[model samples]
Target: MDTPSYRERLNRVLRYIENHLDDSPDLEALSAVACFSPYHFHRIFSAMVGESVAAYVRRLRLERAAMQLSLSDVTITQVALAAGYDSLDAFSRAFRAQFKVLPSAYRRNDGPLEQARRYSIGQPLFYHLAPDVPPIDVQIRSFAPMWVATLRYTGPYDDCYPAWETLMAAMQTQGLLTVDTFACAVSHDNPDITPVDKCRMEVCLSLPPGMTANTLAVRNLLQDKRIYLRVIGSNSDYAVIEVNGPYSLLHPAYRSLYWQWLPQSGREPDDDPGFEVYYNSPQSTEPQDLRTGIFIPLLMG
Candidate 1:
């Protein structure tokens, strides 16, 4: 499975430092909570938590200071010193920066809720989604490499089939492709910023071995990191219809295989090719249509 979000780790680290405030803490000590090396601790903490580790420590101390100021008869000077400030003036300066209120005002009516609320802000692959798609067996095999006359375009995925057809038409005269040929779409753009118009999809054919780039009349298929998954059963079957036709819209599919079958199958996606090859065949004589099996590259232990 992929790593969990950095934010989750940051939250845990924050909880640890906040809870251990009574003990005088050091950077090396706090970094242990995050599992980062001591050398880069400050940078990682700052990047994930949006503040220096020291600043986070300072704010938390003030947050507790605000609480202590309200609940007890402790004077402002004592609360400041207890919260790790050397003097009342220093504590006051830091407190007003974060809470927009001085120690004096906050002690009168301390609010922890408002400060913590700020941290709560907001912050796809093919074969990976199998298993809920039960009976799916996407294997990573050494695909005998082939050459393809290729076409590249960036558009909505629904718009891909047409672009593929254009490539087919352009290469048909050259006999580069034929009926029941395997068609592959290489994903080129990152999911972020490629949601619609910016998303890049490529239609390609495997080229013969020893062929140079110029041999492809159009352009050669660009090798890319991808996932391949095999879709089983005939297209009309409910399970086979997992990939929606153009009319429907859904997510890129959940990575249920990683969640379940991986431990069961003891397999993982291949790292180098980074693709799943789906295997399928035409069970009927339909123009430009046939069965498809998704093949994703995998590394099985």
Candidate 2:
């Protein structure tokens, strides 16, 4: 299948899985959703998503159980069964293997933020915000649609520097980089749910107004470097937060936005993926001096 078509189909399957986590979706059912043959669907899904369908589903279910453990007063047995485990023993074994903590201990010791921190223990690029951190200031803004040249990286978040470097070098070599060039990173998976090594990230550089992927130069550049061109839709309303600090703070900032602020904001997030735009280069800026804008598209009536 062509890239865009396959991507769209897989994305549909992903949404279906997210919405129906309680159901055990078999390969044939999911393949039907993606319009791919059962024989090839698993291969395609594993290649594109960096995980087998079963692994993806199990990870999501476990992560959902974790959220329920921290956010609700549900019993361990209830959470385990809800997660599709046959018994508490089975659930405890699976949960401990993935999270390195017993359900009771995890629930007893952590809230949402603390749970986030616990999951991020080994990932140095992620950090949990202190409970005393100041309240986040959110602004609703409008963004125009734009085209971007993108390079994908699949690994730990902090290890994505090479993708940025390669993409920047390519753009500069193609005379596409300018003083006003807009750059952003698209995170395709939740680090909390997806294993760090399998996380997908896209480093993007906005194309000029009149430029497009079909342009001879852009097309050749993309083909030569195995990069992709994508169009980000305009958002009439997006809840945006300006983050000032190291990249490590981004994950927690997002958690704060989703778990803390969004619940009380009286608005829902649109389907578009959230992204971060950097205002300063990490190479030259102090860790504490870096500025980043986190944009979450908002649903509109």
TM-score of each: 0.37, 0.69
Model 2 weakest 10-residue run by lDDT: 123-132
User: Quick one: best TM-score, which candidate?
Assistant: 2
Give lDDT per model, in order.
0.49, 0.79
lDDT of 1 by residue, 1-301 (tens): 1134444455456556745766666877777776778898778777655578776566556656765664355799999898888888888998788668898876554443222223223311223322233333433334444445445555785577676566556556544555545566555333322236645455565443444555653233222112112221121211112232212212223232332334345554442222212233222334233334333445434
lDDT of 2 at 192: 70
Query: Which one is best on lDDT?
Result: 2
Q: What lDDT score goes with residue 146 in model 1? A: 49
Candidate 1: TM-score? Answer: 0.37
Per-residue lDDT, model 1, residue 134, is 31
Error of 1 at 63 (Å): 34
